[model samples]
Target: MIERKITYQHSFIGQQFIAKLDFTSQYHSLYCARLKSLKYRCISADESGYFSLSEIMEVKVNQSCLIAGIIVCTYADRSSIVEKYISKIGILADRKQSTFYNRRKEEDFIYLEDESGRVRLDLKQYFDWENLITGLVVAVRGVMRENSVLEVIEIFYPSADPPRPLLRKGDEFICFISGIEIGNPSLDPILLNLLSNFLQGNLGNDSAEVAKNIVRFVILGNSLYKADKENSFEQKAYSDISADIVPSISKSLEFFDTFLAELAGILPVDLIPGEMDPSNSSMPQQPLNPYLFPLASRYSALRSFPNPYECKIDGIHILCTSGQNINAIMQFIDTQDPIKILELTMKWRHLAPNAPDALGCIPMQDDDPFIVEDLPNLYVVGGMPNYQKLVTEEGVHCITIPKFTSRQQVVLVNRFTMESETLSFVSVIQGMNNC
Candidate 1:
């Protein structure tokens, strides 16, 4: 095998999200930071200059003006921990709907708010209600009606940063594997072994050549799934329940560690925790404890990163998440297209805009880490239903990787060319059998 000649490096914003938690920080601070970060970009994107922006308080009634603020959605059924607690006090709390999207569309209200105040947005004509959601920072040009509602005429989103030119050209490849679900009893051992063998160059000659160029591998969340069914209604002693849970969790982690060690032995592997993973149930989930992977931890090629991770590989900035942010966004939007959802987040210039509202997020007082201060060259969201990829006009490679356990496939991207393709273990073996 020829020596792989390519430069690779990465730095993470993990520390920004890892600080000691102080419950005093209000969730509003996150919106404030988002507004401050992207407001100028929205203003600059409005090249027509049809209306100049003003503070919500400064807008004159019936006069055309632009205002930048965070979106807030109000509805009787919107997700709220306070309301949920209140509902739990009732007899039927558990029967409540898990999602607020089922509420009648007419009952929903939209508001644009800043430090001064919030105004209802009369967007019935200009925008699709399902496309907009709470917590997005945007600039809207419109006239403030006498009824204290803003009749919007135009909307402006933050401009995307241009992708930097590719620094080099080669066969350099990076593999993205998501939703491994290692501990699931339904997982196919055959497929698992095939994936390992293919990656380790133990397959055919062509497979060996391809695997040799793989510079790195990324495991994007759901590495471990709760395979055991919990009997929610069955009564048990607290100590007994804890005792049963510990063994199950330990067993799952053991399997994940072994699985990861195999891949890390072949190439550097970066692991991001997911919704099912045993990490904090909040946005910017911290990395899984290295101690959990005693075997894999011994390998220098193994790295555990937080959800919504960022780094630059070979000068191409990559922004990735374990699919929680995207999944959260799906609850509010009408479409299921992952690429379109990703594009919406790109336009808003914020990741997980619905954080702390529809989803759990640590209250960040200093800055909104979700804000995309700079657009990255590669944007990846893992654990989608299927693999999807699109290179935006701005040259951002937006990719959604499907769960490997289900698809029996993983996404392979040419680092230098920004070209992407899915490599399926099952199909390769079938092809080999046919030959």
Candidate 2:
């Protein structure tokens, strides 16, 4: 890691690109934005991270007051409360896996706190704590009770935008496809046939015209599939693995290169690396080494990017990740809904809070890359089996572009309105041919 002094420059009209801190403070601006958007009253936000102590003191004991703060669990902090009143108190917690065969009942003992102080919450009276998770921000109007806890009366979360209309779409569109596994000789011929037909306008209808309007095609990651020679004798020997590399060319790699060169020749192709590629399995994973991609190298339209990447295309701020964060949080949590999880992560305004918890990631020194303080116009993630999209309340496009290996689905996002349409090459080609 390199350490360099940061130079700050003053500018009035334009915004500056900067890093974000995820440990805390990333969601403060959102909390404030939410407060203002909802027209909620704040008595004192001196320490805007949570409700201030001064404000709490102003409320006479036994009187009701509005409280806002980050949620915490007192299960690990208070032994007396846990032992004496464990039956009476319910802790907001997730099922933590202590060992492969053992599941531990852990509690975050939901409390609210800021830099000033901490206040325990009793949501039993009004709100169901079942939906609450650690690190969620909330506002609750409640009466003060003994033992420094709040007796819940009302609870609130920021509003989510209504579902978008299907007709509302962006002006220009970009295509996103991932997990092509390009070089594997065992690649499905029907998959290529469908894509080639679409690209070549063999579909013979409005579908072909729609494909023509696609501004660019993004091969989101995992471009290089393992060579067919992986099972060779040299590959089996630890020291002689490089000997198997003697072939210099395998059926999969050659086919993948040819396909990339053809695609890059037609439209701008952005190649990102996945875990299978020669790159680290961490956030900001390295780009595909161009030396290995000869056919793609010949085309000037081809470009490479890190796993989690950001770029501007067609006046749109686009951010993408290879689905590391969502995969991490999904492991311990029981939820199977990817879109719901994506919405929650965006609501929290951080990319992946559970990184390095169960997910493998490259640790950042000071500023965490996952904290998304300033949102992008369109956010895309790959490495899933089905396409999903939602326009967040903040007007940001949240898209989950599915893996191309199984379903052969691709996402088309309108650049202007940020709406998305999922296209299945297999289904489209089959339908068109049968028609």
lDDT of candidate 2?
Answer: 0.59
* Candidate 1 lDDT by residue in tens digits, 215-313: 888888888765334322211222334455677678878877887888877678898988778777677888888999999999988998888878887
| Leading candidate by lDDT | 1
Superposition error at 213 for model 1 (Å):
1.1
Task: Looking at model 1, report the run of 10 residues with the lowest lDDT sum.
Answer: 230-239
Q: Tens-digit lDDT track for model 2 on 249-359?
A: 355567677777877766667777765565665455666668777878988778777767777653456777777666655543435577766876766555665444334
lDDT of each: 0.79, 0.59
- Name the runs in model 2 displaced over 4 angstroms: 1-50, 53-171, 183-187, 202-207, 225-251, 428-435
